[model samples]
Target: MNFKEHIRVIEDFPQQGIRFKDITTLLKNGQMYKAAIDELREKVKHLEIDLIAGPEARGFVVGAPLAYALDVGFIPIRKSGKLPGETIEADYNLEYGKDKLAMHKDAILPGQKVLIADDLLATGGTIQTSIDLIKQLGGEVIGSAFMIELMSLNGRDKLPSELEIITLMQY
Candidate 1:
């Protein structure tokens, strides 16, 4: 569906030499957004997924709808302190510093199969932290999905070698 064409690239966004791939342009278009969800759904439907997990913000944008399409629960992986109740967290080392992400302790039952989703795979820090949190809670990460991936970063190398990845577009 040429999902990449719908992505907005802002050069030097958020910082110098950083090209941000914005999905808002694609989200605003109902057809492409639906197609993206449908495609993601198709990619993971064959798997035995008990829940769809995603990081905060952008992940919510793509993960929630896909969760609905799959008829599975959506588990939000949020920044530290964003979630109430007992939670588990993993800290990731960012380019400048460290960032922490958390998810509810009971969000996943032991042995539940989870599929992580996100808007893009950049450095893989966010999702890798998310995967750690999920595994810490005993949820097996069946696979990971993304709307777009920045290949130059080699983010996949940071992820678990056995984990499957699905991305609609790469930049």
Candidate 2:
């Protein structure tokens, strides 16, 4: 579906020398949104995914639907203090600074296979922290998924070698 075309590019957004790939435009178009998710679903269908863990905000948008399509449970990896229960947290570096991500302590069970999802993979910090949280709780991260990847940033290099990374579009 050429999902990249649906993404809006904004220059120097939230900082200088940075190009932001906005997904709002893609989400506005119902058909394209569904098609994009369907494509992601197809890629992960063969994996024995026990749960889908999506980082806060945009990740929830695609992750929720993907979990439903795959008939697996969805776990929210939120910003610190966002989740109400006892949680496990991981600190990571951001483009500008450091941030922390939290997930419910009971979100993942031991030996369960998890797939991490997000709208984009830029620096790989957020997703990497997500993988750490899952591991701390004894869940194994089988793979990671993204709608868009800034290949120039080389985010994939930071991820573990055992994990499979799937991205629908690359920029």
Candidate 3:
């Protein structure tokens, strides 16, 4: 689908020497956005996923549509305190520092299979933490999907060897 053409690479965004691949350019185009989700959905459809778990805000953008397309529930893994009721949390390291993500204590049930989705995969900290949170609740992480992956960061290497990550484009 020539997905890379839809992406915009901004030099030194939010920091120096960082080339950020912005998906908003692609997201603004309905055809491109749908194509991305369709591709991601197709990749994960064969997996036994009872729910789609999206991390934070961007994840919602990608994961919600996938969950809808697959007729599965979408669970949002948000920043700490964003979700009401009892919650479980995981702390993960980022390039500069650390951050925490949380999910409702009951968001995932024992033995439930979850597919994690996000807009991009950089260092894999976010998705890895999402996997930990899901597993803490007894949910099995079956697979993961992303619209873009920053391969230079070697993010895929940080993920568990058993996981299959499907990305629409890489840079």
Candidate 4:
């Protein structure tokens, strides 16, 4: 679908010397949005996923629809204190600051297969922390998927070797 073409590259966004790949441009277009979800769905069709877990905000945009397409339950890995129940939390470092992610305490069943989805894979800290939260709750991370990945960041190196990662576009 040439998803990369739909992404807007902004120079020095929110900081200096950083080029941000924005997906909102593609997200706002219905055709491109549908194509993206379809592509992501096709890539993970072979995986035996019991749940689709997405990080907060943007992750929810792609994750929820992907879960429906795959006919699996959706789990939300949200920012700290966002979940309205007993929750599990993980703290991690971001490029500018530290942040935490939380999930419902009973979100995943023991030994359930989970596929983590997010809009972009940057430093891998957020996704990696989500993976840890899923494991701590006894779920097995089958793979991780994203619409875009910043390859230069080398985020994949921080993840488990056995975990499969699929991305539609790389920048």
Candidate 5:
């Protein structure tokens, strides 16, 4: 569907020398957004996904809809202190420093299959940390899906070799 056309690339966004692929443009278009979720659902439907886990903010936009399409539960992975009740957190390295993501302790049942979803994969730190949280809960990370991938950053390299990674757009 030439999904790339729906994306808006902003140069030096949030910082200089960095190009950010913004999905808000695509998301605002109702038809395009549904098509994207359907496409992503098609890509991962065969994985027998038991749950869709997405990191905070943008992750919710992608994962929640995909989980609904797939008829599975959606787990929210948030910043530390964002979630109430018992939670487990994993620390990750950001471009400038370290940050932590937390998920409810009971978010995933033992040995259940999980698919990690997010808007962008830049350095793989966030997704990698997400994988740790899933594994710590005894959930198997079968794959990951993203709306965009910055290939030059080699974000996929940081992910486990056996994990199936899918992206709708790359730049």
Candidate 6:
């Protein structure tokens, strides 16, 4: 569907020499957003996913809808203290700085299959930390998905060698 056309790229955003690919352009267009989620659904439908987990903020936008389309429950992986119940957290580095993400202790059943989804895959720190939290809860990370991937960042290098990754577009 040529999803790239709907993305907005800004040069030197959030820092010098950094180009940020913003998905809000695509998100504002309902048709395009649905198409992207539908496409992602097609790509991961074959997997036996018990729940869709995503980090706070942008991840919620992409993950919730995809989870609905996939007919699975959505587990929010939020920043520390954002969740109400007892939660487990994993620290990670961001392109701009460092942060920690938390997930509810009871979010995943033991050995449940999970697929992590997010708006962007930049340094892999967020997803990697998410993987750590999920594993700590005894959930098996079946795969990870993203709306955009920055190839130059080599984010995939930080992830497990066997974990499957899917991205709708690359920059």
Name the runs in model 4 displaced over 4 angstroms.
none
Alpha carbon deviation, residue 27, candidate 4 (Å): 0.6
Q: Give the alpha carbon lDDT tens digit for every residue of 51-150 in model 2.
A: 9999999999989999999999999999999999999898998765798999999998899999999999988899899999999999999999999998
lDDT of 5 by residue, 12-43 (tens): 87788777788999999999999999999999
Which structure is stronger by lDDT: 4 or 5? 5
lDDT, candidate 1, residue 156?
Answer: 88
Candidate 4 per-residue lDDT over residues 1-171, each given as its tens digit = 799889999998868878988889999999999999999999999999999999998899989999999999999999998888999999997654689999999999999999999999989898899999999999999999999999988888888999999999988
lDDT of 3 by residue, 1-171 (tens): 899999999988868888888889999999989988998888889998899999998999999999999999999999998998899999998654688999999898899999999999999999999999999999999899999888888999999999989898888
lDDT of each: 0.91, 0.93, 0.92, 0.93, 0.94, 0.95
Residue 116 in candidate 3 has what lDDT?
A: 96
- Give Cα distance to truth, residue 88, candidate 1, Å: 1.3
TM-scores of all models?
0.96, 0.98, 0.97, 0.97, 0.97, 0.98
Superior candidate under lDDT, 3 versus 6: 6
Task: TM-score for candidate 3, please give it.
Answer: 0.97
Please give me the total number of clashing residue pairs in predicted model 3: 0
Error of 1 at 139 (Å): 0.6
User: What are the per-residue Cα lDDT tens digits for candidate 6 across 1-171?
Assistant: 899999999999989988889899999999999999999999999999999998998999999999999999999999999999999988899988899999999999999999999999989999999999999999999999999999889998889998999999988
Q: Rate residue 155 of model 3 by lDDT.
A: 90
> For residues 72-95, could you state the per-residue lDDT of candidate 1 as single tens digits?
999999989999889887889753
Q: What is the lDDT of candidate 3?
A: 0.92
The per-prediction tally of clashing pairs is 0, 0, 0, 0, 0, 0
Count clashing residue pairs in model 4: 0
